[model samples]
Target: MAVNQMKNRMQALGLLDRSFKAASDDDLGDALERLDDEHREALESFVDEVSVDGVRAGVRTGRIDGGMEAIAAIVTDAALADTIEQLGDHAESPSSEQLREVLPGVVERHRLGVTRIMLAGTVVGEAPASAIIRDLLKNDETLALPPAPEVEIAPLLDTSKRSSDEQAELRAKRKAAKAAKKDAERARRAQSAAARGR
Candidate 1:
């Protein structure tokens, strides 16, 4: 058989399994250190060959789509939150100008991907960043999470107005209602059973 066919036959028969072994971190490091200069240089070159676009594309694979407000929370503090509040209805979304002003600081500080910078600017400031922010936001390759979900809040109950006696009465009424419901259910079941028997 040809050498290629012979190697394929060996692989099919599991002989290739003996050619590789899992190594511990220390053992791998020692092996690398022991390599000759030429071999080490080749490995370094392979590492250096990774491109920014490749990294960015990899990050984009996990990108999530949502409103910008969450992005703002990650990159901004109380001052920025207050700034957003001051914008009133406009605060619902960040403007491009706000993004231009704030995104560089956010990107530099957080090491976020370009989409996050865009989101932070629009969500927190109600605008997208200018070219300045866009430029700064590019070339980043870090993985990022989706924004926080908006929570629905209910108004607090004012219990101070109710007297102790009234509170006790309310609890008693609730207990009575629950007992009545159980009695009514039992009666309904009894009627069904009687009808079936007849």
Candidate 2:
């Protein structure tokens, strides 16, 4: 496959290694941790969809039993799970064993990077590229790192900035307003009492 074509395929499979490398693992982990149950399920489903067992089945037999058997078989085969986990989305969809067989060199070339990045992301507790990309699409900031120190901060005199005197003056005004309200209430009560006496 051409470079552009391979990149496009990799992206469709959801392994953007460059973005994964640039992202902080802590940020990604926090984001994954914060996922609602539904999104967590979706992430798991997505992972299964791209798993090596899923892919190897898709590639070898084109999901002849509609993938259920493949999924079941994967549970028992550590080797297949490891391979699928390494292959990620590259193992899924239209690219079958025949396709790879037909264009072994091209298919291998595209799959190399996809497998490498997926393997790298699966190191221990780090967030996988697939999960991070899914959360990122929903505009979740959990995968985002804190702002860099070099980033330009707002000026110290922004709208919320207030001097000590200004705060004191505001407090005094509030106090005066409270006093005036109390005086008004006293006057009204005195008027009511006087009218009652008459």
Q: What C-alpha lDDT values do all the predictions have?
A: 0.38, 0.38
lDDT of 1: 0.38
lDDT of 1 by residue, 60-96 (tens): 3212221112212322233344445444465545454
TM-score of each predicted structure versus truth: 0.21, 0.21
Candidate 1 segments whose C-alpha is farther than 4 A from its true place: 1-156
Model 2, poorest ten-residue lDDT window? 62-71
> Across residues 105-166, which tens digit of lDDT does each residue of candidate 2 receive?
42243233232333323321123343433333223332232222355777675634778899
Error of 1 at 142 (Å): 49
Give lDDT: candidate 2, residue 126: 27
- Compute the lDDT of residue 146 as modeled in candidate 1: 33
